[model samples]
Target: MSLLQNVSSPADLKGLSAPQVEALAQEIRDFLVESVSKTGGHLGPNLGVVELTLAMHRVFDSPHDTLVFDTGHQAYVHKLLTGRHDFSALKKQGGLSGYPSRAESEHDVVENSHASTSLSWAEGIAAARRLSGERDRHTVAVIGDGALTGGMAWEALNNIAVDKDLPLTIVVNDNERSYAPTIGGISHHLASLRATRRYEKVLDWGRETLTRTPVVGAAMYETLHGVKKGLKDIVAPQEGMFEDLGIKYLGPINGHDTPALEEALTLARDFGGPVIVHAITEKGRGYAPAASDIDGDQWHGIGKFNPETGLPFEVSGRIWTDEFNEEMVRLGAERPDLVAITAAMLIPVGLDGFAAAYPDRVFDVGIAEQHAVTMASGLAFAGMHPVVAVYATFLNRAFDQLLMDCALHKQGVTFVLDRAGITGSDGPSHNGMWDMTISSIVPGLQLAAPRDGEQVKQQLREAVDVDDAPTVVRFPKGDVGESITAQRQDGSLDVLLDVQGNPEVLIVGVGAMCSLALTAADKLVAQGHSTMVVDPRWVLPISDDLLRLASQAQHVVVIEDNLVTGGIGASLRSALQEDDQWQPVHTFGVPKRFLEHASRGQVLEEVGLTADVVSTTMLDRLGPTASGRSD
Candidate 1:
């Protein structure tokens, strides 16, 4: 049996000899390369952290020693070591999660997949351990250098450093990229440290030489430490950023070297105070294809691919993201006032095409969602029609900015929320179910949900034209369902009125929900029930035409991919009630809770958003008497 096969947990790993452990690291790497090739996960990050994770397991007693992973994509190796090695059904419906799950393992402390914030979690754990009188246990936070660019990481560092006595070890995994190339002050500081070779050499020599001295050795060591600190301040002004905050800064060590990592970790364990270990590892190590790729973001999260060739599995043609990119390019050409913005996700949201086409018009703010939102608002306020293209989940980070800066100020800011639904495989942190519920609370904001590629184009145009208040156009992650030609473009209202007669049931479908609604309508028609499937392009600001249709219909079913509570359904229900019409309304959407990792289709199916489920629900509601009337 292989070394990997023998190991079920860290305890099992601890039983192996040093040479055996070294061999096991290679075995684990091979397993990862093979497993992720089939499963399609954060392969690059996981491949980079094998030795670091092995060293961590060796150094610390986990479940007792709190180990927090920032942006849990890199925790795949940690997960495997903690006995979640069954990668057969990884990220699928009934399989292992993409991120750390507390339910899955005792070792997995935090389930944060977002960049930065692990330091905060580590500090919290350290504080709790102290309170509980478990001082022997260590709190280790493993964060990528890319994640350190985020403001929250610095805030946590500042707080952690305040209490020098706190037992914490922050492992800075410097892979030189987070989705894209890392930006900001922290990246530069790390780069400077990496360039400086004398810092490590001097420290090592000083420590060795000072200890050997017979008398006044301790005093000489203290004096040498002060001199080293003074020199570091000159070489790297920001070198003492963490140390100044009261935390001791360790080496910019080679993270891939098992012995080196183990040694550094041992030192950290021995040190009874806050310390930051800066370890450098190449992202996508061992895999030449991924390592050589200049654009690391593209290879960061991949689909099922051939391990040998690094070729992805075939998927459906052009998605909504592609369509958005095409439209944005066209719009930018037509309107010089139009500007595109994203929070470090230029490639994912299909903005790479737009950025390439009009580099001057596109702005990529690095991992600062709140800043991106407000910056877009500023652009809009300055007469530029700013379109902030962001993932639906990430937009939640800037809710207050969207409300106060854009909505309250009545800035003509257009928000194109991509992946605005149950985005599976990426796990819970990535799902866009909260966009509708959260945006529904933003006053003076107009919200839209497009059915397909054509609707997305039309709605985007309309949103850009609305120069009065903030407007949001949301669409799902995958391909646009059944390409439809543009029919009519009524000013700010893209209507597809295909109602046969005075329909009793009006299926008001939001963005991606239109396809399911149409299928449901077909089933209702077969059951002899007269139904009207209307694509109400705008979800918010309840259009007069939409309200009129809703008032006339006996029952209205509001279909959206977002949460049922506090969604567009609630707005529709309120609009119908205020009209003095007692029309019964049913909301079909995801429940207001964190769902498990699964495919978008599987998640939708589970939540009864599929065509079959919708059809059955409509049939059950509109029984034999209602089924008598033919369209």
Candidate 2:
């Protein structure tokens, strides 16, 4: 009676009748809502793809067929079908991963969460199969319409089009959104395709009418279906984009209809070439709360919430995003020359308020980070200071563009990197740990890591004022917390903690790590060791004050929320070494390794970033009797 529990693998779906499959779909949706509500995972995207993913598994032999999901967040349904049913500890350490993990199952092929990459992965996999002479094996890439806006997707499409013999099937899951509603030309094309419902209706009519008449009538209808392309040209003229590219095109199929999805996918599996099976599905189909969300982002990636009311249990306080959101609105009013840009996330990066107030000034370039960065450079060339807001991890996509277009040409573009540092639950790919390291390599790029809400506002203003080069203001994921005021200003450095005696320990905290640095300094002070803590507002171009302080101290400690290697701490140590000021500098930061999924606090504690740990480590480095005076 329980269709979901009985169905453990794709093999189990083979024996089930059409009615059973339909029941299983509803079961899957109910399971998703209940499980994800408790665990706080990607509920909406998974719900939308239930029927689509079910149809794929039922049609193709996965693990052998090789199905890759673009932006693997939607692979939750895929995970369930492949025997990973426990959703109790999703996105937690020692539990199931939010994205597809190779260690979890053989069914998952690609695990990268970055969007617009499935087409390229499919291309490579399909090409390898061809060279290996594995004709029976097929490759399927389920890419969202939002991902199609990316330049890499187009590049892969161009490559795949030329290879008619490549055994690849591209399913464009046209959900009409990626966080926000998808923008640009690809979305428009998909919208046009969705509008051709008349053509589908006519075919359905012909099939029903012809089958009833007789054998001759069925034959006539089959002939009509074969030449439906010419008929489509007359009826739906906007339908040849994929066909023109030498890839076989099939249906603007209803993605939620399991039977209809099966028919389209089966045809694609047998086609033996690169085919684009366009599926039109809702972002949030079954769940009433997600489906009714007007702005379309609340359920995209949600926190733990009540399934009945669809509200979070705890009300969030003013976060890092809130500060950025308020400041952007104020900045829009003050500076007309300030324009805003986001890859596709207008709402997520705190530009929604700015867009609402000054609609003409903000641009959502879809899921194309490279284009957004270079376009910002062009806007800068035209005398407007463009603010490109994006997640710190995503900034990795446009490194060459930032280095060559913005920095090389001397463009004044402000990059607001939200969710910087250890973003624990989303896993390794989502963490913003590499921005400081990567941005440090770029010449004339001034980077800032804001300590609190007030500093996020202050540093953002300073970032936009630079007209000769690019600037970056990065902050972490959660709450901004209590603001830490400075005891004294030391030439652009904010000294939060200073001891009366001659300081032996000099602690330099970068951005959000300043609070932790001050806490660690207090621990040393309580132990009768004089310690001084300072935050260099602008982390780059290692300040004269920092070098002067480092020279006077017996031990220099630099802590940051970025990669220890090549981060600001490393840069400061290198600067000190270059100046021949060897005060035995110690750098503290995220280790240069892929971290597992956990809470931010849990990850920090594991990495020994706690106040107690840091102070004890510093004390051990200094002898037990060591104090303000070294000897």
* lDDT tens digits, residue span 21-89, model 2: 888899999998899888898988888999999999998888889999999989998988998889999
List lDDT for all candidates, in order: 0.80, 0.87
- What does candidate 1's lDDT look like per residue over 32-60, in tens digits? 87898898889888888888999899878
Can you give the TM-score per candidate against the true fold? Answer: 0.92, 0.94
Among these predicted structures, which one has the highest TM-score? Answer: 2
Measured by lDDT, the strongest candidate is 2
For each of the candidates, give the backbone clash count: 2, 0
